[model samples]
Target: MVSSRERIKAFDKKLLKSGEYSVILSRLPAYIFELLLIVIATSGDKLSEMDVFIVMYAWGLTFYIAPYLNIWENRKNVSIYEVLKSLPVNQWDIFKVRVEYIAKLLLSRFLIMLGLQIPGFMMTGKILKENMINSLAAIGWAALVLTIYALPGISNYRSNKQIKWKAKQGGIMWKKM
Candidate 1:
């Protein structure tokens, strides 16, 4: 029997081949902008409250909007969930792989942002508390937004139903079965 890790790896490889990974490429600009925000938030000795607020707001907005854009662009194509459903893989394994992938991406960015603050702290002997707080808030906002967007579909999948999108009268309709 294939180990769970091996099964997830196989499913991930198939997902990659199915062009599901292209969503990352499509959101590259947003990712770069997010990185720049992290650098700006962490590089300074003293970040103004306004500066931190603006940066965090932009970061959160990017996190919220990028997923919508990706979904809109791919609305006509079969979704990764649909493709996975057609496979012989277990549903729980699919959920694990997806959640793990998202967690890794988010955690890596958060770690990089935290790491970037180290040099300034080392030189100044002071932590930029406001910037750090804002950064934490931004990441928390991102996780919340993603969770809100993901939970319904995940629950539906767990319940052995799928959401199908169909066009009717030039608009989209969601049919869950």
Candidate 2:
């Protein structure tokens, strides 16, 4: 049988070539066009480069995560019973594939931000600009891995703490990572 990892790589390669992906990628062009318009519209006036970075960050945040969030939201409409009836290998395979896609999207966004930051830094220089990009780069790789691994248990970790607190009339225990 073909492995789930292979399936996901194939799917991503397909998606990268698809028109929908083209549309998604075109968002950057639209963003750049809008920024040009902003500059043109304010041609007589002075503006902060900070303002441009702020707008770019806000817009890119939406575009960066929209596709993954859409996938998660669609899962809400799926029938749990129907899914449960699927074969174990298929289920495991598909689950892994979805995780891979989500992971890839996250990594892609991180790299895109890092890629964009260099140009912005060139434009803004270190003295006037806040150093978010440099700071983000310092931690981005490790944070990405932790964020993915943290997803499986982060909420429950909080919930478990609450549960322990509520039951502390008997006793309490703590485990360190």
Candidate 3:
């Protein structure tokens, strides 16, 4: 059996070659804004409660907006799911790979945010408890938002037999006359 890591690497390569990474550019503003918020929250001698709240809100907003931005960006193109389906891999593996890809993407961002805190500590000579808590909360909220966004796709892949059945039937629908 092929390893999940190998599958993910293959998918990543394909996505990269197809210029799918460009879609991330659409989210550049959110990323920059989040980073700015982090800098603001961490650079001070004392943590501001208001700054922490703004950082939390910014994280939540960024996470919440990501799914919609992805959908909109890919609306005119073949989706990652469809690309995975076209591959020779099993349906279950396809689902796993997609979820793993998303997880890795989110994880990298989380790590970057955490790493950004280090500079703030160096500059300020102290780590703020509130900032740490804010980081944890942001990641928790991101995971929740991503999971909620992923549910519909997860449901579609949960039953391969159902999908096959619908595909075979051409998924016909009746419209009101």
TM-score of each: 0.58, 0.36, 0.54
* Candidate 2 or 1, higher lDDT: 1
Model 3 clash pairs? Answer: none
For model 2, residues 106-154, the per-residue Cα lDDT tens digits are 4654455445555555664543133444324323443354344324243
Off by over 4 Å in 2: 4-76, 79-84, 88-90, 127-177
Q: Which ten residues in a row have the lowest lDDT in candidate 2?
A: 72-81
Task: Compare candidates 2 and 3 on TM-score and give the better one.
Answer: 3
Model 1 segments beyond 4 Å from truth? 17-24, 45-75, 121-126, 152-177
Give me candidate 1's TM-score against the actual structure. Answer: 0.58
Candidate 3 lDDT over 79-158, as tens digits, reads 34444555665655544554565567667666766677677877877765656676666666656655554453643343
* Stretch of 10 with least lDDT, candidate 1: 64-73
Each prediction's whole-model lDDT (CA): 0.54, 0.42, 0.53
In candidate 3, what residue range of length 10 has the lowest lDDT sum?
A: 69-78
Error of 1 at 126 (Å): 5.9
Candidate number with greatest TM-score: 1
